[model samples]
Target: MVTSIILINAERTKINEVAEKLQEIAGISEVYSVSGKYDLVAIIRVKTNDDLADLVTNKMLAIDGIAKTETMLAFQAYSRHDLEAMFAVGM
Candidate 1:
Protein backbone atom coordinates (compact mmCIF):
# COMPACT_ATOMS: atom_id res chain seq x y z
CA MET A 1 0.00 0.00 0.00
CA VAL A 2 1.11 3.52 -0.71
CA THR A 3 0.48 6.06 2.04
CA SER A 4 0.60 9.80 1.62
CA ILE A 5 -0.20 12.86 3.68
CA ILE A 6 -1.62 15.88 1.94
CA LEU A 7 -1.59 19.24 3.69
CA ILE A 8 -4.19 21.51 2.19
CA ASN A 9 -4.82 25.22 2.24
CA ALA A 10 -8.41 25.88 1.43
CA GLU A 11 -10.39 29.09 1.18
CA ARG A 12 -10.85 30.34 4.73
CA THR A 13 -14.59 30.17 4.43
CA LYS A 14 -14.62 26.66 2.97
CA ILE A 15 -12.49 24.56 5.29
CA ASN A 16 -15.35 22.40 6.46
CA GLU A 17 -16.66 21.86 2.98
CA VAL A 18 -13.24 21.00 1.66
CA ALA A 19 -12.65 18.49 4.46
CA GLU A 20 -16.01 16.88 3.84
CA LYS A 21 -15.27 16.55 0.15
CA LEU A 22 -11.87 15.04 0.78
CA GLN A 23 -13.32 12.45 3.13
CA GLU A 24 -15.72 11.33 0.44
CA ILE A 25 -12.92 10.55 -1.99
CA ALA A 26 -12.13 6.86 -2.45
CA GLY A 27 -8.35 6.92 -2.03
CA ILE A 28 -8.38 9.31 0.90
CA SER A 29 -8.81 7.34 4.07
CA GLU A 30 -9.06 10.24 6.50
CA VAL A 31 -9.41 13.99 6.56
CA TYR A 32 -8.55 16.10 9.58
CA SER A 33 -9.31 19.72 10.26
CA VAL A 34 -6.23 20.96 12.04
CA SER A 35 -4.81 24.20 13.32
CA GLY A 36 -1.41 25.55 12.26
CA LYS A 37 0.22 26.23 8.91
CA TYR A 38 -2.32 24.16 7.04
CA ASP A 39 -6.08 24.11 7.42
CA LEU A 40 -6.78 20.47 6.62
CA VAL A 41 -4.78 17.27 6.48
CA ALA A 42 -5.79 14.36 4.24
CA ILE A 43 -4.52 10.82 4.54
CA ILE A 44 -4.36 8.98 1.21
CA ARG A 45 -3.88 5.27 0.78
CA VAL A 46 -3.55 3.75 -2.68
CA LYS A 47 -2.16 0.73 -4.47
CA THR A 48 0.56 2.53 -6.41
CA ASN A 49 2.30 5.83 -7.05
CA ASP A 50 0.37 6.33 -10.26
CA ASP A 51 -2.88 5.94 -8.38
CA LEU A 52 -1.74 8.53 -5.87
CA ALA A 53 -0.77 10.96 -8.59
CA ASP A 54 -4.11 10.56 -10.30
CA LEU A 55 -5.96 11.05 -7.04
CA VAL A 56 -4.05 14.22 -6.14
CA THR A 57 -3.83 15.82 -9.55
CA ASN A 58 -7.06 14.69 -11.12
CA LYS A 59 -9.46 14.47 -8.20
CA MET A 60 -8.19 16.36 -5.14
CA LEU A 61 -6.91 19.47 -6.89
CA ALA A 62 -10.13 19.82 -8.84
CA ILE A 63 -12.11 20.70 -5.72
CA ASP A 64 -13.32 24.28 -5.88
CA GLY A 65 -12.27 25.58 -2.45
CA ILE A 66 -8.81 24.10 -2.44
CA ALA A 67 -6.21 26.80 -2.89
CA LYS A 68 -2.96 24.92 -2.46
CA THR A 69 -1.56 21.63 -1.21
CA GLU A 70 1.66 19.96 -0.16
CA THR A 71 1.87 16.21 -0.50
CA MET A 72 4.22 13.98 1.47
CA LEU A 73 5.01 10.34 0.72
CA ALA A 74 5.53 7.94 3.60
CA PHE A 75 8.14 5.19 3.37
CA GLN A 76 7.09 3.13 6.36
CA ALA A 77 4.30 2.79 8.88
CA TYR A 78 5.07 2.46 12.59
CA SER A 79 1.99 1.81 14.59
CA ARG A 80 2.08 -0.68 17.46
CA HIS A 81 -1.61 -1.43 17.27
CA ASP A 82 -1.59 -1.97 13.52
CA LEU A 83 1.52 -4.15 13.66
CA GLU A 84 0.04 -6.32 16.37
CA ALA A 85 -3.18 -6.75 14.44
CA MET A 86 -1.35 -7.77 11.29
CA PHE A 87 1.23 -10.13 12.79
CA ALA A 88 -0.22 -11.24 16.12
CA VAL A 89 1.68 -11.37 19.46
CA GLY A 90 5.10 -13.08 19.56
CA MET A 91 4.96 -14.09 15.96
Candidate 2:
Protein backbone atom coordinates (compact mmCIF):
# COMPACT_ATOMS: atom_id res chain seq x y z
CA MET A 1 0.00 0.00 0.00
CA VAL A 2 1.06 3.55 -0.66
CA THR A 3 0.33 6.07 2.06
CA SER A 4 0.30 9.82 1.88
CA ILE A 5 -0.10 12.61 4.40
CA ILE A 6 -1.99 15.60 3.11
CA LEU A 7 -2.03 18.93 4.90
CA ILE A 8 -5.07 20.93 3.92
CA ASN A 9 -5.91 24.59 4.20
CA ALA A 10 -9.64 25.05 4.05
CA GLU A 11 -12.13 27.84 4.35
CA ARG A 12 -12.39 28.39 8.09
CA THR A 13 -16.15 28.45 8.11
CA LYS A 14 -16.41 25.38 5.93
CA ILE A 15 -13.91 23.07 7.56
CA ASN A 16 -16.49 20.60 8.75
CA GLU A 17 -18.20 20.50 5.41
CA VAL A 18 -14.88 20.03 3.67
CA ALA A 19 -13.91 17.22 6.01
CA GLU A 20 -17.23 15.50 5.49
CA LYS A 21 -16.85 15.66 1.76
CA LEU A 22 -13.28 14.41 1.96
CA GLN A 23 -14.41 11.37 3.89
CA GLU A 24 -16.54 10.38 0.94
CA ILE A 25 -13.64 10.21 -1.47
CA ALA A 26 -12.11 6.83 -2.25
CA GLY A 27 -8.52 6.21 -1.06
CA ILE A 28 -8.96 8.71 1.80
CA SER A 29 -8.54 6.77 5.00
CA GLU A 30 -8.72 9.45 7.67
CA VAL A 31 -9.33 13.14 8.21
CA TYR A 32 -8.35 15.22 11.19
CA SER A 33 -9.01 18.77 12.28
CA VAL A 34 -5.84 20.38 13.56
CA SER A 35 -4.39 23.70 14.64
CA GLY A 36 -1.37 25.27 12.92
CA LYS A 37 -0.43 26.33 9.39
CA TYR A 38 -2.99 23.86 8.11
CA ASP A 39 -6.62 23.39 9.08
CA LEU A 40 -6.92 19.68 8.38
CA VAL A 41 -4.82 16.60 7.80
CA ALA A 42 -5.80 13.62 5.71
CA ILE A 43 -4.39 10.12 5.42
CA ILE A 44 -4.65 8.57 1.98
CA ARG A 45 -3.98 4.92 1.23
CA VAL A 46 -3.91 3.46 -2.26
CA LYS A 47 -2.63 0.49 -4.19
CA THR A 48 -0.24 2.38 -6.46
CA ASN A 49 1.43 5.72 -7.07
CA ASP A 50 -0.88 6.44 -10.01
CA ASP A 51 -3.92 5.98 -7.81
CA LEU A 52 -2.44 8.31 -5.23
CA ALA A 53 -1.82 10.96 -7.84
CA ASP A 54 -5.34 10.67 -9.22
CA LEU A 55 -6.87 10.87 -5.76
CA VAL A 56 -5.01 14.04 -4.78
CA THR A 57 -5.03 15.82 -8.09
CA ASN A 58 -8.34 14.80 -9.59
CA LYS A 59 -10.47 14.33 -6.52
CA MET A 60 -9.04 16.14 -3.49
CA LEU A 61 -8.11 19.35 -5.26
CA ALA A 62 -11.52 19.60 -6.84
CA ILE A 63 -13.29 19.81 -3.53
CA ASP A 64 -15.13 23.09 -2.99
CA GLY A 65 -13.67 24.49 0.24
CA ILE A 66 -10.07 23.36 -0.01
CA ALA A 67 -7.88 26.42 -0.28
CA LYS A 68 -4.50 24.76 -0.43
CA THR A 69 -2.79 21.48 0.21
CA GLU A 70 0.63 20.01 0.85
CA THR A 71 1.03 16.35 0.07
CA MET A 72 3.86 14.20 1.38
CA LEU A 73 4.41 10.67 0.09
CA ALA A 74 5.45 8.25 2.80
CA PHE A 75 8.78 6.49 2.26
CA GLN A 76 8.75 4.22 5.30
CA ALA A 77 6.66 3.48 8.35
CA TYR A 78 7.80 2.48 11.86
CA SER A 79 5.88 1.96 15.04
CA ARG A 80 6.68 1.27 18.68
CA HIS A 81 4.57 -1.89 18.71
CA ASP A 82 6.32 -3.33 15.66
CA LEU A 83 9.76 -2.62 17.10
CA GLU A 84 8.88 -4.20 20.45
CA ALA A 85 7.50 -7.31 18.78
CA MET A 86 10.70 -7.77 16.79
CA PHE A 87 12.88 -7.48 19.92
CA ALA A 88 10.61 -9.83 21.90
CA VAL A 89 10.95 -12.54 19.24
CA GLY A 90 14.76 -12.26 19.39
CA MET A 91 14.80 -12.62 23.18
TM-score of each: 0.90, 0.84
- Clash count, one per candidate: 0, 0
lDDT of 2 by residue, 1-91 (tens): 8989999999989999999999999899899999989999999989999999999889987889999999999888796854897799995
Q: After best superposition, candidate 2 residue 90: deviation in angstroms?
A: 20
Candidate 1 lDDT over 1-91, as tens digits, reads 8999999999999999999989999999889999999999999999999999999989987789999999999998897855886876556
Q: List the residue pairs that clash in candidate 1.
A: none
User: In model 2, which runs have C-alpha deviations exceeding 4 angstroms?
Assistant: 80-91
Q: lDDT of all predictions, in order shown? A: 0.92, 0.92
Clashing pairs in 2: none
